[model samples]
Target: MVRRFGNGTATARAREEALGKLPSPRGRLPVIGHLHLLGSFPHVSLRDLAAQHGRDGLMLLRLGAVPTLVVSSPAAAQAVLRTHDHVFASRPHSPVTDILFYGSTDVAFCPYGHHWRQVKKIATTHLLTARKVRSYRHAREHEVRLVVAKLRRDAVGGDAVNMSDLLNAFANDVICHAVSGKSFRKQGHNKLFRELVEANSSLIGGFNLEDHFPALVKLDIIKRMVCAKARRVHKMWDDLLDSLIDHHASKPASERGGEDCDFIDVLLSVQQEYNLTKDHIKAQLTIMFEAGTDTSFIVLEYAMVRLMQSPHLMAKLQAEVRNTVPKEKDTVTEDDLTGLAYLKAVIKETLRLHMPAPLLVPHLSMAGCDVNGYTIPSETRVIVNSWALARDPSGWESAEEFVPERFLEGGSAAAVDYRGNDFLYLPFGAGRRICPGINFAIVTVEIMLANLMYHFDWKLPPRSGAGRWH
Candidate 1:
């Protein structure tokens, strides 16, 4: 007994020594530690704090009971996301995820292990493959056409179109079609999905009280409060998902899971083979809906905002899109997107400046690992401040400016890409947990942006132009 106790004591001491080696700011309170230091915008605050106190772009903060590691530089990002990826591939299961994601079985929030690997495989192999996305080209093009038509119709009245709603609807419908082979808006599910996504975002997208004070949440009152809200949301999701899955499953085998099938059909077809539960299917579909619907719209909205602010860049992109597609064509097709370098560059630049998930879904270290010559103990919550890495002046020229040309030929970041290859600009993250829907999301944005440029000359309204795009 004495020997075992002595060994455990040595291990605990070593763990503390390892964590103590990393740079951390002072002012750790008795219970909350550094929670008070992080303000309204934790990402921005963390970025500034890291600049001041981080060593080799690594900063440690004791966020309540959790020990958090903030990664801010390219080298440090590579170390944590690539060299030690397997060790940090899992997620920290928060109360929100457990309640909403049906015990956290979805790809985005699922803990890494046999289940995650299998779920991700189903997503990549069956749902989000390049071929699968390509197969939906007609559906995507049709969605874009609807948007262009809506804008043109509104222009005749000289009334301003709500680009946010249009872009959001376009994104929502595209994902809905891909997931359930239905039009989300026409079927009256568009607003429902948006509401649920917003509700889920409020819970899952950031650090919550339960995340900081994990033990405190275990108390009956707090647990009931958190679980009640999430469960209410989950019940709505469950009802909708059941209807969609049932609609698809009732179809004949050949018609449902053959050459063309929605995500539900595919999931149902593979259910028996994969030994998946009904809850598992719903969880995967939910993340796909939430992540898919949100990413494309934000990129589209911000791209327009940035373009409206900079006329030159907008003109440059418009020229490329207009000149590349034949004059005979009324709308830009996916094929016309070929060799549209500036168009892709503009989208790439937008993602860099405004990734939907700035501090990407937190990665949990599964085992003790050495990063930047310091040991990160097992189960440490790791956050890669990707926003800082992408915007750091050290690695980017004119970093603060919205210059898409940097991604074109002969520019500084010309070699950089978002596909986990270059760590400097990780818009979609990297390594094992890199987003699998990149192709689906990018192509959807491209078709829409390309057509918007090809068909129209944008101008801010007389009243809304000044100081608005910024």
Candidate 2:
């Protein structure tokens, strides 16, 4: 029998043979190739370089010891994230994430393999399923009610609410209850959760000298700082997760029964089925709380900022939300969200403009592949510049503007969806590695937003003079 490519392997090989070397910036340095060119904002910097070096919107750069491919256009993104998705599904390894996220044992950063697949299977099927998320509706509604009460108090006091802080707290409360079965803030202790989030943010906010400069990898000062911080964060995070797990583990399996068990309880129940240990349970919980809470607040903050900037748009969404839910109803339920098309559009527009993770977490190629006629070597770090792709002029009209109307009926952007099918608008990303928590995230956001809009009228600080949202 003649051997043949089963699923596009032959086609990819042919394309790679036809196309030669990948496009890269010239004058790369000896050790820190192309690292000097990237400023603080790497997404914007890469976008600029792509304009000059990306022949087909794919540009290769050497960041110290790592060879990275930046995909700055929608077509290029499709080739990497969809056309050859399986080949590039694994995540890149970083010392920072390894320490902070338990050696990338968590679902978000774990490499693509048996372990990752198993964890993902358990999480998607049992932990984060739509039914599982729906079971937590009471927790969500209760948290949102608390948020509204706080905001109403501020409103009565005639004070300008710090919307970002308020939303962050709201997200934190919801995630805490859903994950560990209680709110740390409400307990007035164990604020370690919030501290961990801040530490992780600081460590991963941007590229550090150690990341790009292999020569500095052994520097004692850098190692000490990184290790010390990691140890501190790990200790606190571990203790908290351990206590939660132990608290649940102490209970008899029968007593911990039912669909309403918190995430910790559920993970413990299936520990033997999935062959999961306490460490594995902790890693997953850490990610769930960190990723869930942070992204929710970021998206909410941006949406509110955009709405405040455009009063007319705010009023329009608010009216839709208000009309959908009766005046007598205390809060909007998940059922009411289905009919609020405009509100959905507003959230979609917000994600397009301000994606929480602009690069959609860096992906590593498991094998060599061809993308848009460019040969990408195995283990190459791939970054899909979702920020640039979302604002590409070719795919979107007035892409820079905040226009929710584009997603309305009969508009050019109306047919496009953000569930990753349309590469031109992947806020959550595409392929097998797409964010599995999308449904959970969407429901959490929609319900909270529906209540926020239905209840109060928001305005900018008096005489602030339309300052920058950031």
Candidate 3:
């Protein structure tokens, strides 16, 4: 990042000078630039750095060879994510994603362009539409039932159930049902999906030298070392997806289009319509599987962890769920989820406090744009510190506390929401790249949590304590 060439032209030098105006935290070192300013957790590091040196919610950092613009407050977020969304809506190229997602063809990682437009249209209009999400109600309910059954069998007589494993399995099974089909468990494919998702998450989430030092990957040794695991995981995914797609494709075309179709089936039926190659179809499904399984599981696990640490919140949520749900039903159905104010409040609070992706996916500026009186150069990568924005002391009352009631009627933040309308609480993000699976993810969480709360009273295991979980 410290490499400096002779000032070649007015435009190049001018752009460099403009970037200098953006505030940067102290302690930058040679070659690494601001990379050393970041600690073990980049989001926390950015939040602390932004507080000390940020100007007008904007801070600039040179992450190795790349120069990034960090937006750390609600106003700046609105300026970038809303006002100049088109200018900063595209994703930067990543070598890892390129291999895993078939040259970055998936909706989440694809750069902003015509292909992105087409796939996003297919997803929003047909694949992940509200009606389409509703169509998976039975499958979701069945998965919840299976979860309840497993908990009943495993947690008998003061045994401590591993909610982490249980919830992870539930989330995976739910996604499997949605993606592959009902009979996926006959040969333990759900377990395989879980393993692949974990491998992918760890590989992508961990530190990668190529991300910061792009030039190093050009060497044969560095390229092989960096891309070997990605290649393995991609093939694993490809083989599994190919088998499932072939199964769906083998069936007569006459029987394929309906509410019973899995995600793969839906993608195939519209392959010609969307001009999708088999790679394209597999790419979309891979991204969808990873997103669907990982996101819901993390949120659910964190919600349970937080609630266990707070007895009042737990009781409040349980009371609302048990009282509102009909006693005759064996499990809480999606229909029973309506009007459960506290349940929804708990979910909203969970999302606000523990956004799965603390940093919104990195966005690359397509053109120069002025934000909050500062000029951002074209091709500048932007990251919104969502964790900072949601928990800002200036914006939220009791910003550090886990208070779900704040989302209730007449509460301090009753008007705030996650749909990007309110910049302060953007768990699902805003604008064109906002998560298309919001409906799918939210309903999945609601049904499983509601059923878990209704069917059993949660507590710490007998070996650990005789008291309440807290």
TM-score of each: 0.95, 0.92, 0.95
Off-target runs (Cα >4 Å) in candidate 1 are 1-10, 183-186, 462-470
Give the C-alpha lDDT of model 2: 0.82
* Candidate 1 to truth, TM: 0.95
Per residue, candidate 2 scores C-alpha lDDT tens digits across 290-340 of 788877888898888889889999999999998879999988888788999
- Show how many residue pairs clash in every candidate, following the order shown: 0, 0, 0
Candidate 2 residue spans exceeding 4 A from truth: 1-20, 183-186, 214-222, 463-470
Deviating ranges (above 4 Å) for candidate 3 = 1-8, 461-470
Judging by lDDT, tell me the better candidate of 1 and 2: 1
RMSD of each: 2.9, 4.1, 3.5
Report every candidate's CA lDDT: 0.87, 0.82, 0.87
**lDDT score for residue 405 of model 2:** 88
Deviation in Å, model 3, residue 424 alpha carbon: 0.9
RMSD of model 3, in Å?
3.5
Provide the lDDT at 181 for model 2: 77
**lDDT of each residue in 137-157, candidate 1, tens digit only:** 998998888988888998997
Clashing pairs in 1: none
lDDT of 3 by residue, 80-199 (tens): 888888887899888888888899999998999999998899889888999899999999999999999988998776667889898899899998988888768985799999999998
